[model samples]
Target: MRKERKMDVDDEQVQVMDLEAQQKKTSESDLPKIQKKAKHPVILKFKDVVYKVKFPSQRKKFFKQTTSSPVRERVILNSISGVVYPGEMLAMLGPSGSGKTTLLTALGGRLGGNLKGSITYDGKPFSNQMKRNTGFVTQDDVLHAHLTVTETLVYTALLRLPNTFTKEQKIGVAEEVIIQMGLTRCKNSIIGGPLLRGVSGGERKRVSIAQEMLIDPSLLFLDEPTSGLDSTTAQRIVSVLWELAQGGRTVVMTIHQPSSRLFYMFHKVLLLSEGNSLYFGSGSHVMDYFESVGYVPSVPMNPADFLLDLANGVSPDESEDIVTVKEKLIVAYKNNIANELKADLREEENEEADHRKEANTEIEKWPTTWWQQYTVLLKRGLRERKHESFNILKIAQVLIVAFIVGLLWWQSKITHLQDQVGLLYFSTGFWGFFPLFDAIFAFPPERMVLAKERSSGMYRLSSYFFARMVSDLPVELILPTVYVIITYFMGGLKRNAASFLYYLFSLLLSIMVSQGLGLALGALVMDLKAATTLGSVLMLTFLLAGGFYVQNIPAFIKWIKYLSILNYNFKLLLGSQFKPGDTYPCDGDTKVCLVEDFPSVRSVGIRGQFVSAIVLVIMFVGYRLIAYFALTRIGVTRKSRTTKSWLLCLD
Candidate 1:
């Protein structure tokens, strides 16, 4: 009786599992079908594509044992060749160091440095036109966490699509992509990740894909779209890619490990091991080819697992070692498929030169005008900052600090001249420190996002930097204004209205200069901890060089004061505060008297105010220019291809 009860319970569990599976199928079926479009065939062919790069000392340890040298040259990808036709989804399968992402970047036209290859689209050599018509979805999704799905895609479409598209047309395209990506249910939801509350991981991934789809490129490349997702979610993403391919767009993506069901969705598979192709053939024929080569799989084996295991040095032949099996497979692939690819490419090469020329000419033009990019980026910047940029905490911090400072220097009188000087110094330091730190934290997190957008040719670096700074000016003005209003009267400065306004303007200039320094520092270093440390050290040096700290210095080292932003600010403030033709009460022994009928204007006269303001303006523009150069150089890093994506993943 007990045995029968156990059997009945097992049967009940099986039935429940079947019911859940049925429900999942029903839910998926209820979603809208993907819209179809006319297919444009883009035949991508590469021959003897070799990528050789210098391995910095830090990265040399990851490769085979190398000699001790200052610089090392390593072949990342060796004599690789393959072809991916239109309407096909090619899956690049490999272990971590297999250079799958590198290959993808090379094909997508983002790779730099020493690359030797012949890559052609259609029958002509690859050109800028090919790049313009291609879209790349990185492994790490880089979206504004504060923006909703619809907002993010709208902005992307506006920047990426042609200028001929009307604003309403851009919006329509965004909505269509949203529905195509199956993100309609969460269209209005924010794309929050670790730092905020919003959409799920699956939704975020879809948003990234949706963003690239806005351009309607003939070719799309994705780097590990299924990584970090569950089996069910991974399968769903693959199914979406399959639907995309059905519409005539060529899709290529690097996949780490896909389930057996997901594996069959690919039209072709390119298996890479240590940067060399082990096999390049139809997805269905991969197993048959391996079996023909004597790597027979057990019944009902997961094909993806079997291939990954083989690439990772798992040998099926008991008599042969793992390395031997890999070599055998590589040799067999080259002998069978490599020559055929080259021969076929030769046949197609003479077909069309005029068409390629026309495409190249059309691709030379920017999709949108410069003014359009600036306005769109400006809007995006403002919207992204709405929630977190001016939070209660920042306002409270400024007010509390201002109140404390006001109390410390309560209604300071001219009789206490040293106290007044101290107040001036303190105010300069406060404005310089807070604005600098605020700007420092602001740019590093956005560095990755900027890199991703820049790589996609979304806008000019100058436009993005200008738009960001312009958007930030309003908030930058607020804190310094609040500090001045609260403390100016309490500190008891010159009572004239013109004098007060001059002082406020000087403080604003100083704050903006400080903010520029922060942006430069953050852009100089991609790592937060490193940037913070460097910024602190530089700030301390500037503080020492500021005039209030050390009045007289050796002539040789006196030049340091010029680099100190605070020194210039203080001079402007002091110059504007005192009248030129007034006598000051002085002690008999003192060279310069603090308590007097009228203060001396010898150190930096009224002229200093105008000169310093001009200098501050120059500094603001200078730092921003440096930041732009830094960002452009940082799109690719030593660590990985998805540097910006990794940055977005950080809180």
Candidate 2:
């Protein structure tokens, strides 16, 4: 019996060894194939990068003092310098106000201002081609929440990948990225928002990274990739980055409070303090460098924590002044790492001059055509807006308002001039107000996603704007049609088919114009709360000038009525109901008064409200143009001899 048991144990041990061998073989086969370096391996180097902005003086309030001069110049980055080579995972660490993110944006060439610095890629000045080849992952995920993980990645791949790739190839890349990021299990799951239940935070973060990876960029920049993630999930993300670096792509990211294990995964570390670099060196050697300089950690602490403490001018014993310690570290870095960085850059330049010429000889255009962009974006927009566009609440709001108004003015007669005027005014005001508010939320919520995608050169501002406008029109017209259908017959106005059709057409045009105004307001304000407030105020002002409550205005302010959408819509609705030469019951001083005999446009000019309809169309196009410009001009800076607000106020 003992001999038989020994034989079984030996057999089990042999089986375990065989399994281990097979696992090793599988991992080896799965490894990314090593490829030769291209003529242009990107090596990013920035020197003396200084970024500054001017802000208004608090004493000179717009309502009070009225002086237009700015009193303060805030320096966001103070002569920062760094070198990032290919095949390196560089980690940037800093405290709350350390300018880490600012520097990253500057390096990615996304910031707008008077930048005084030298930033070179591949031993030459950075060009749009380099920008095209670079991938940037912003802190916010900036994804469409309703889209499934696979659908989101596939759409991004379509927009970003080169046109040379076939549709199947683009889809394959999306699938590969999903497998690589370990997201295949939930690829069909939706990326839910704050109010929705969907994927986990970690999965969403992975999807963000996956989208950027589809293009296979040479250099990637990420801002806070592991932010709002658990320690284990954060470590997993860093591990993937390490693998990417090993595959010969340059990865630079800003991290806050990374775990010790995650810290060790980085090949290099750049530490910043108040816009100053206190240390830029190898990650493994950072602790030793600090120790040699007489600043050793007394207890077992995270290397990330220790480095942040040193960067913030805190010593191990807490006895030294911050300024003194900061100065000491700055001087030490200058003496130790600065020269080494300079020497390495010089050597790379000497070796890669020929490669630079070959790599950047031609500028690359967008992979997809304008038409392709428009179609793809239009489809995606329609899909993304499916829930918001025709939701029950919005439809119900319009229906309930229309039903209430219809009941109140049940079968209103033209004999009662005041009641007819009130119905016309209320219809105009309600449709105008509802659609305008609906459009207000459209652009502000998607601004960040648009900004990020625009920075990546996915599509033109015109294509995106046009596609969004077109996709929304169909679904948006549904509720307005319902409102008009229910209200027009119930209120007993315009019983003839021709008049009813005219009224319905006028109402539809008004809703579209109101939505355009809302879109423009949203783009101009760029914040939901601010846009909503401004929209409400504008609606109230337009209501007052709508030619119903207060007629016979002074000539000076009569021109303001032209600016009111309510005025034109109300006129059209009134003109449709009271036709040319139509007579009303004789209750007034004048018996059998004709509709055209009223003292208004009926006898004066532009008969039948056709001109009003044309004007409404013009307003729709005009507001849409304003919205396009507002969206395109984002992140613009105007340097007049005047002060600018620190808040993101439109110029």
Candidate 3:
């Protein structure tokens, strides 16, 4: 029996080994196919690229009279040139004032200046195809702070991956990217900001990189990926980047001073100073180039540190003037390296013309359908903002305000017509301002995120706008509904179910109108302080013309009352609470009723209530349309003045 058991165990072990060997053989066979699929690598080539900004003429004060000087042109990048091939990482190293970022932006097709010269991907001009295949990581981490790492990437993948990919496939892609970027441990961690506690700096940076990698971009550009990390963490980040380059990505990053270990990881380095290229070559041969140019450092030092020192106009030989050293380096680069780069670029360009002809025929479309974008964006918006919308403090604020208002006017008599009218007006005005301020913050904080996503062509502007409005509607209306329920009963308004719903409906419509205006103002200004100030002034004007505060506004200014959302809201509220011919008790021996004749009540007559509602609905839609138009004009979409003007006329 023992012998038979031993034979069975040996057979099982042999079977397991055979299975392992087959699996290994399968993986090895698949490796070349994967590599071949990714072998259509993008090569970035730039030649004589120059960026300049024109400063307006300065006004001079002479004898108390102002005279303008001629406009001056400041060169941000002065004829910079370089090439980055696939499977290579290029680092742009410089001091504070150098044009490393400017050149990087130019190559990324994001620079907004008088940029001259050629920048091509795979010897083709920048096109939508190139844009789709390129990924850019900005310096500042522009992720939502409340979302978990996995949530962030998953939403990005859903919105960004092609519509051909199923939802499960997109999710699987996000998970694969997370694992590839080594973020599995912090996949569930929140990306925190100044006031929140969550992931570390290294994790946040990794999340940013992972976000770009979700699309498997062939070309990647990063602006200072290691800005604030410690040496070890920075090295780890660079190591990940090295692996990405090894996968046939052309990676270019503007780096601040890097540690020696980090420096060696880069395959190529471009050193710049004052908008001029100092050196551009293989990272390991930089010292050799400098030594050949007769500027070798006397002592061994970190290559990055030594390069930065030279770029900053510091000389290895103490006797050389800084200005002279800079001129010499620039001259040496122009004389020795520029011609060779140009010749290579010309040869490559000749070889790529046929390839470009074939590639140019391909058409690009949005990755997701409109409905798909809306659904994914809606889900993401709900998850990201649920915390802010339903936080304890915000809930408490609404409850406290409701309780206070309810107690202040608790169970007033029907005869108290003035008190009832005051309550109705207060409800209109409170909702008017409550949602305005809340909605004003919507677009300003999100401007960066919106710009980033739009640049990447993740979804349509209309889809995003509609999804944002739809997601905000429920969250924005809940508090006001609660406020009405508390104050309506305690304040002794009409107790009928229809009347209650009407009151609720009127206040909610008012909130929607005000929220639309807030969105418009926020999108228009896009500056928090400025938008808030403008909103305060606009709301105050509306309040004064709302018929309760100034019943008989001046004729020239009376037109504003029609424009005031609160005016229509106040009228609707009055119509909802009081019916025609309603009366209240009067102070007299005969008890003559005068509620119907009250000036404030008569001004906001109970009739034509539906007209007020129709107008409110129009304004609600109009304000949102204006906000959308403003966003399109301000880079949210391709600007079309004809479309904007036609829409405004229709509105």
Best by lDDT: 3
Cα lDDT of model 2 by residue, 1-651, tens digit: 445535544654464466345333533454232232322458888877886767655663565766566558777677777788888989999887788887787788776565677677766665667766788988888899999999999999988888889989999989988887778889999999999988998888889988888878778899999999998778667766766776678889999899866776778899988777777878867776787778877765788999989888899999999999999988887888777765665545544677567656766667788998899899899888898888888778877888998898898877775676677778889888888988998888887788788878888888898899998897668777888888888787878898888788888889899999999999899899999999999999888877766667778988878888988898888777765667766565567876655544342222537777788899999999899999976433223322322221110
Mind sharing the TM-score for model 1?
0.88
| Tens-place lDDT digits, model 1, residues 77-165 | 77778888778999999888887887888788777666787777775665656656788998988889999999999999999888779
Candidate 2: count of backbone clashes, pairs at least 3 residues apart or interchain? 0
Q: How does residue 31 of candidate 3 score in lDDT?
A: 19
- Which portions of model 1 miss their true places by more than 4 Å? 1-31, 56-71, 348-360, 581-607, 636-651
Question: Comparing 2 and 3 by lDDT, which wins?
Answer: 3
lDDT assessment of candidate 1: 0.77
The number of clashing residue pairs in each candidate reads 0, 0, 0
After superposition, which runs of candidate 3 have C-alpha atoms over 4 Å from their true positions? 1-39, 60-70, 347-356, 587-596, 633-651
Lowest summed lDDT across 10 adjacent residues in model 1 is found at: 642-651
lDDT (Cα, tens digit) per residue for candidate 3, span 288-397: 68877877666657778889889878887667888998999999998889888877777555566776786677555588889999998999999888888888998899
Q: How accurate is candidate 3 locally (lDDT)?
A: 0.82
| Worst window of 10 by summed lDDT in candidate 2 | 642-651
Residue 629's lDDT within candidate 2 is 91
